[model samples]
Target: MAWRYRVGLVVAAVALLGAGAAQAYDVAPHRAVYRMALAKAASGSGIATAEGAMALEWGESCEGWTVEQRYRLKLGYTQGGESDVAVSFATYEAKDGSSYRFFIERARPGSMPENISGKAVRGPAGVRAEFEAPEPVKLDLPKDVLFPTQHSLAILGAAEAGQKFLSGMVFDGNEVEEATEITAVIGKQIPAPTEGEELLRRPSWPVRLAFFGPDNAPGGLPDYEMGIRLYDNGIVTEMKLDYGDFVVDATLDKLEKLPKPGC
Candidate 1:
């Protein structure tokens, strides 16, 4: 599998959000833990078995919004090789979508870790990025694009208004901090089901997103696909990742609400 798609899991939690008028979304600070396992493998996927755990924590401060995402997966491929993959991604994005700072690191057993750290700002002219790792370079981002949290909120806002589909571009610090085409499908919104402790307190809807990059040639399929149940407060209760070759299911194991940062 391609490195981009493999590390895409690092930013997976930021892909589904709302962007409609039916309801107002308030970003909630919370920590979520997910138990991951392979659901199935395709004909020539080379994947035999897999297991993993992932965590995503979102917080808010005066400077911007902060996110911490990490994953550790063990994969056994049919080609008779095994690998332990690790990924860590962190970012701080401004509320008004003006600036973003990101750091991403990926590693595999017996291999040196590779990292990308940079900052990007959006100005009237356009967006620009300066990298500090994997060699220094400047990148020009798409003028019309959203960062992870911004994109997620857009999805939520739309679902609240019963919008079925939205088309846009998003930059989640993937390969080169470039924006990738995104198509989000918002499903029916319903009240959060009552639980013993009532861990959730807002309405939620089903969301499915397809991500396509420049590398994905025309008429070709999206690099990856995601399906999730997103809460009105911007928390995901359930999710799945479809990587074309294989599919993985992430079940919410536990969740904890955090205090909002005060500046």
Candidate 2:
């Protein structure tokens, strides 16, 4: 259950940062960047693979940019058939550098609230994201649940040492590298995710993410891998997740260039 909660939160953040409304043209100068990462693990017992892509877009509207993300996974167990799962189709707004609002549209089967709209506010000490359900449902996130969400922003926002962005959290970058590698680069613009359009655009900084095997212990989970390609303005062009027995793939099928939001 805790793993499910963490995965759900990670998926929500990813969807908002990678797939939501903020694209390269819509973001402000020097405010935000884009990143994509893949993760894979394969074991004799089962194979698990995941692909995550994110966009960091700044907003003059809310003072801080929004994050859009999209992710997919394919898992196969030695004794069971393969299963494909997608998590959190949503956008998140972080305003004034500390508060967050999430607009979630989709989730894996039976893994989310009926209608998902929520708010989270972070202080100098900690951050908490809350959801509003029609009826009260017991929701408890694992201790490590905030790592990806908070640390992702801290890394993007350029937080420094001795500063408490997520407060009381110490992220071992080396540990992160053990499981995933975040690579930043510049790339040519590609078509946006549109229905039936062909146009080329370039972004300022593009990033890719690759996840490796579980090095935490021997005889761990299998080796799985995924890759996401993103633009500086926060548009994802391609996503891939592959394990020996399962795979999920998505490409920028279409894109639409809209008028830049008035600052």
Candidate 3:
């Protein structure tokens, strides 16, 4: 598979939800409305090889607010030997109990490659896809992309109502292997910085996540450990993937409520 497609699959897998319930968090609700920013760097021999950042915002609507729920992701990466960089964006919204929609876009710096945009629908049976291409073309997704466990995990985390799916499970990728287990880890409250006094600063709680997996089961290596810091409010603020010679870190930043499109 191509690198761009691989990246998109990773993002979709991490952000979408599956059919099972998620593990419960032992935190309070007041601390759930904050935003988290993460910065990740991968380096070797004292030279930085790859760097990326992610930001997440979770909050209720203010007075007279029409929007109910929102989630967005922006990712960029630079490989060690590659000269060109890659960037991608994904955004999702819950319209009601019966329907939701998502948008995805990816681009390389110089080439006019065809951009991807599609929507997924959910109903009584299961989830299905309805996509549109910029031109007359065909697209195929990985096996895991169609049945993503990470996306299901994120949804379970955000809902905080499911706890049965977080137990002993294995996530197998063509090049990556991840195991999910529930463990009690201490969390801390981080204070939000004030910019201008008018902006409200919400308190954020950070919790550590640990598990065992292959260094890069599908694309790169095997036998590695991964750790991530997730805010109590259900946003992954930081992630570190280590496989001896290669390491990747991701951070979140600049989280704001996405504006609703006018009809």
Candidate 4:
């Protein structure tokens, strides 16, 4: 359920920023591949061992920024057989964070594939999300909220300012209901990432986020937590996904810079 953390990160990492914006990190278009493995599983979770791979490509189009993400996880069970979980998602987010359109699908063993498609626009009141696939429903966004890319940039800015704790509301269209309550703790800035490739070794910070729903939150335990080794340019070199019952670690295996449109 907290897997929305990963989904939001993918959306946040796949966007364009117009020039001359005051931001702590410059956004870029790139592709990243990660090797993933289950780090831990609580008892009775029915998980024996799991391995997966993820690939995400963020590129700019004439109309907006485009994102493509694919993930596959093979899980061997303690009781019996094995199952593969697959998810594919793509979206377009406007440079100004005023709107977003997304398409997502999830498939698993012995189950019908689930699909969601929608668009959202920000107005004076707040964001209004409209869903077309699965069903038609409208969801309300909170006030003073940030979209995916804006949320990422805000976190980076706070980290750069040496602020250790930050809180905000973020809407990534990962959920069909409401926005997520985000609380982040930023660690000291590191001059280099020891295990990262050349392009990833730049100044960065360690960030962790606890995500929750709006109701009874801050008092309620987070549904999930995510830790990231985030570079100044919105690239995450390493990540830990904590799903309450289980945890998974992701390592960036390949990184490639994509060509940007000439100014």
TM-score of candidate 4 to 2 decimals: 0.87
- Which 10-residue window in model 4 sums to the lowest lDDT? 13-22
**Candidate 1 stretches greater than 4 Å from native:** 2-24
lDDT (10s digit) by residue, model 2, range 160-189: 122212222311111112123222222343
Badly placed stretches (over 4 Å) of model 2 are 1-88, 105-117, 133-199, 203-207, 210-225
Model with the higher lDDT, candidate 3 or 4: 4
Candidate with the greatest lDDT versus the true structure: 1
Judged by whole-model lDDT over C-alpha atoms, candidate 1 comes out at: 0.75
lDDT at 257, model 4: 91
| lDDT per residue as tens, model 1, 2-56 | 6243444322222332222212456678898999889998998899998898899
Q: What would the TM-scores of all predictions be?
A: 0.90, 0.44, 0.44, 0.87
Give Cα-based local distance difference scores for all models.
0.75, 0.36, 0.33, 0.74
Error of 2 at 50 (Å): 14
lDDT of 1 at 236: 81
Query: Which number leads on TM-score?
Result: 1
Query: Which digits, one per residue and each the tens of the lDDT, describe model 3 over residues 1-263?
Result: 01212222221113333322222332111211222222333342332344433323222221111112222323333433433333343434342222223343444557774354454444556444444544332223222232222443443353343332232222322221222222223344456546632222434433333332324344333344334554333444455544344445554443443432332
